[model samples]
Target: MRINVLQHTPNEGPGSIATWAELHGHALFTYHPYQFGQLPTAVETDMLIILGGPMSPNDDLPWIKAERVLIQDLLARDVPMFGACYGAQQITKALGYPVSKAPTKEVGWVPVYRQSSVIPNLPDNLNVLHWHEEMFEIPTEATWLFASAAVRNQGFVLNHRVVGLQFHVEPRQNNVREMVVNDFPYIKGSVLNQTAEDILRVTVSGKNERALFAILDYIIE
Candidate 1:
């Protein structure tokens, strides 16, 4: 299976998802949106991944609008898609669902709990890194899979194939380092309360990667 990754920014990446994909022997393709060109071809993808970015889905940029159209078509095709953070928000908008500011921004390692355990494979508490200002409302037609203490709708699944996660499951060292650096500007005042290094030190080490791989494994297979 070919796993195509849609990256809306230079810094965000597949992280531990890459490790899992390589281990599963699936071809990984990445569409870097910042490259300034048409979206990459997806004719070969058995699954699609819409990665996280700092930009809002409501941004008026042409690329953002174009991506919305493309994502809508992908939904029409019913291709298996897994989205993270901003990507999840984008999917929410494209699906005619609502997304709004959460009561507060959730950053660093937050505890996401299994809502109902219908999947029968997830844990009661999952500590995952989050970096998003917005949150999604579970589409009326979809089933919510997880909820974090910081946000009510952490993730949702559509038809057991398309899934959206509001947290970063990619716990690779590079992902953590890059996010800390590039995301600093958005986290300015919050830094006074808690340093990025301190947050990283606490959140970076955990079994989150294994749980993330399990989600991907379940989705792709």
Candidate 2:
């Protein structure tokens, strides 16, 4: 299978997703729309993974708009897609739902509770990394998957093929370090936000990676 990834920043890449793809013998490709301004068409994408970013989906950038259009096209064709954070917001916006400011800027390791049993093997609650100021609204047709105390809409699943997570489940240790280093300024002194030292101090466990892989497998199945 040809798995295409849409990355918005250099810091945010397909961490464990790439590993999962390699283990499954699938080809993985990444496109940096922020830098190269190119995206894969639906025909070329067997599975689409949209990574997180610092930008908002409401931004008036040309590439953001183009990516939303591509998302809409892919949705029309029933292409399996997995979106993280900003990518999740983009998918919600593309589906004609609203993406608004979250109650608070959640940036750290937070616990998200599983609200639906659509995807198996997910624990009732898991501490996943989060870095977002805005949240995506669950579409009327989508099943509410997960929720955290800080954000009500932590994740959603649509059509049993598209999944959107408002947290960072694909980040490895190095990926988290890069995110903490590059987007350090975004982390403020909030009740939900964690300090750089604290975020870095916590080890990146294999549980999150397994959860991410499970979601990916569920989407493609």
Candidate 3:
């Protein structure tokens, strides 16, 4: 299978998802919008994976708008998609919703409460990496999958093909380190936010990693 990964930044590449694609013998075509100008076409990829970023979906960047247009085009084609953090917001925006600022930043290892029965073998509470200040509401036709105390719209699934996750379940240890290093200004002592030291100290447990793969499997299958 061919998977096109839309990366918003150099640091937030497809972490565990890249490992999955490599191990499963799937082709990976990555586009770094920060460096590269254009997004991928649906005809070129069997699946689309949008990774996280520091920018909001509501940003005034030209690429951001183009990415949303690409998303809508892909959805029209019924291509399977998985989005994380800022990517989730992009999907929500493409679905005709507004991405707005949250009450506070959710930046650390946080628990996301499951809400939908769409995802099989899901835990009631999922511990994942949260690193965003913006959130989006579940789109009109999408099923709400996860939520947290800090944010109500943590995840959503549409037609079992398109999925959006507000947290970073696909992050590896190195991915976390790079994100912390690049966005250290957002770290602070708060209810949801965690310090760089604490963020680095927490190991990437196997459970969250498995959950991420499971979600990916479900979306593609």
Evaluated with TM-score, which candidate comes out highest?
2
How do the residues 108-178 of candidate 2 rate in per-residue lDDT, one tens digit apiece? Answer: 99889999999999888888899888999999999999999978999999998999999989999999999
> How many backbone clashes can be found in candidate 1?
0
In model 1, which range of ten residues has the least summed lDDT?
Answer: 185-194
Worst 10 residues of 3 by lDDT: 185-194
Error of 2 at 172 (Å): 0.6
TM-score of each: 0.91, 0.98, 0.95
lDDT of each: 0.77, 0.92, 0.87
* Candidate 1 per-residue lDDT over residues 1-221, each given as its tens digit: 88878897877888888888888888898887756646745465678888998888877788877777777877877777889998888889999877788767777766788775545467777777778778888888888888876578899888767788888877587778788888776655431245687656765545678777667766655
lDDT of 3 by residue, 38-133 (tens): 788768879999888878888899998999988999999899999999999899999999999877778888889999878897788878888888
* Segments of candidate 3 deviating more than 4 angstroms: none
* Native-referenced Cα lDDT, model 3: 0.87
Ranking by TM-score: 2, 3, 1
Report the C-alpha displacement of residue 111, candidate 1, in angstroms.
Answer: 0.7
